[model samples]
Target: MEDFVYFFSFQDPNVAMVVAGITLLSISAAMVGTFTFLDKKALLGDAISHAVLPGVCLAFMFAGSKNPYWIVLGAFITGAISTYAIEWISNSTKLKEDTVIAAVLSVFFGIGILLLTQLQQTGDAALSGLDHFLFGNAISIVYEDLMVYGILALLVIICILVFYKEFKLIIFNPSFAESVGLPVKRLKLLFNTLLVMAVVTGIQAIGVVLMAALLITPPAAARFWSNRLHVILMLAVLFAVLSGIAGAFISFAVPHMPTGPWVVMAISFIAFASFFFAGKKGILSKWYNQRNYQQKIHRDHILKSLFQALEKNSKTLEKDEIMEYFPGKEKLTRTYISKLEQENKIELEGEKLKLTPSGLVEAKRVVRLHRLWELYLAQYLNLAPDHVHDMAEKMEHLLTPELEAKLDASLDYPTQDPHHSKIPRDNDL
Candidate 1:
């Protein structure tokens, strides 16, 4: 905990500034990333990240130094060109999107590597830190580099805020937006430009290789936690910021470690957690809900068996006879019966199993729904009476009150089902 306190204490202004710069870059990338993820253009971010490498190397060669302006300009140019080429290839050829992206990524990265190798062979002192762009040296980002990143981050944030509604419309229904004269094409171009700008800004702090994670994973992870567009954007920004901070701190604490991979690792950790723990859509929650629903079905089926036994024999069913209905599911049936009894839905008197009044009403309701559905399918859907019973057996438990009402109205209040069984009346059991 002492290490944690020291990390946040701002004992060194350089550490504080590096953290701030990482936070800014992360927020910007995450905001743009959310739109890309929603639009199913996540691979485009990866393409841009790799494709910007040639531009950075060219900028260094032209400027003869590690100048921010030259690097950013070159990056923007290459990134934009890569995006246009991807679109053009996709439209003009039969190649799939993944194929186009992979092609562009490999070509551009190869060129960048070639240029870097040539520069290294020259033994130029100005190109000393050029290799750092492959991984990242977040702690080495000076104040000047931070200023450039900060300005770019600000521009990205402003653009997103101003065009929030338009972007959302384009993502969800581009054809409709175009029909409404919203300039969908121009909006896409502008969005792509912003994405490129985001990639360029992080080239130094996060690097080209792992920078795609900054622009993809946070937003992808955030999506599991929200459906609202605004909420998703906010959550994505929060996740990105957390990852950036953690990555920067780890780089600080552990000497010589690259910050980009650490940042990706942090973002992935959050994403994995969200997949398993977030409410409503999470895997664990889904499993729990499914288990509970199955338990409910089992209890209802038990009550149904008791009602059927009483209908046939005019007496309670023996526990052993009820267990026979479940065959190999004796343990599950036993637990279900115990739970039903605990809930006062069923009674166990000696060896006899009987439903309480509440259980009888519920069982009748389930049976009534099943028979009503069978009749509806047989008469209205033109399904054979023999085929309708099996279908209704599955549909009965899932019918909602509104659906039941619709079915009742459609069937015109039938008195007897296709199987010749009397349909239970509202007050009859």
Candidate 2:
């Protein structure tokens, strides 16, 4: 508890600096990553992240230490080169983008690993914390590191905000952007530069290996909760900030844990939760909605069956006769019956069941919709009456009142379906 309080209090200058740097990096990475994700260039971020490792190694060897300026410059140059390589290889060959990204990632990362191994063999004293870049040590972010990374992060964020519309156009509709006299190629190049810079800023705090997760996961999780681009960006930033701070706090409390893995873990958890529990798009929500839809269909089927029987001069049905309609689904049928009774849509007098007035009104609408659709299919689509029944059965429960009206108008408000049965109207009920 004390550790939590002290860590977040920003009371210490070092803690305050770490939080500021990480917050800036998170904002920039999330903003860039949201567009990258929408454009389906996620693997490109992964490739660029791994490709920057060799640059980190080369910078360390040349400078004899981890100078933030040298590291950022080298990392940005190599990351940009990797981005170009991916684009060139993809456009020049028959290879897919993922294949090109995978190849570049493997080759550049392999060279980086080899160079890093050689640097370690040299036994340079300045190499004390060099390995921290692989899996980040956010605790090691000094003033110099913060200055370089923070400034670059701010630049990336500002550019994203300034060119938001252009970026959106290029990402979602590049051909349209070009048609409107927008420099699609230049905007793409600029966005790619900012992408590399965003990844470069995180190489120290979030690490090369796990930085892609920090870039991609927040936006992915945010997407489940929103459809608007701006709202998604804001949510992604919120998620990134939470996970980034949680990772930093874990690093502060733990003896030697890397902040990058923890940050990835935190963000991944958010993604997993979003996948299962987010509204409208989540697994649980979808299941609930599907269940409700199925139940409504079943209830409609029962009501329709009762109404059809009433039309044939049988006002009520024995409960056993109704169960016979749903062979193996007696229990579920009973549940639906109970629900309808509760809603006053149906009445159960002893073992006999019949629709109430409100239920008859609903039943008439359902039957009308089914017959209307069947007539529409038979007349306009030239489908046989037999073929239309099955399709109408599925679509009967899905049409809204407005759609039903439109369908009726399109069909000229017919009185009979393709089968020549009278389509029940409200007066008939």
lDDT per residue for candidate 2 within 123-221, as digits (tens), equals: 989899899999999999999999999999999999999999999999889999999999999999999999999999999999999999988999999
Alpha-carbon shift of residue 172 in model 1 (angstroms):
0.8
lDDT of each: 0.88, 0.94
lDDT of 2 at 280: 91
Where is model 2 more than 4 Å wrong at Cα?
none
Candidate 2 lDDT score at position 140: 94
Which tens-of-lDDT digit does each residue in 321-411 have in candidate 1?
A: 9888999999999998888889888898897888888888888878778889899888778998899977887788888889888887888
How many steric clashes between backbone atoms does each model show?
0, 0
Worst 10 residues of 1 by lDDT: 307-316
Task: State TM-scores per candidate.
Answer: 0.95, 0.99
Clashes of 1: 0
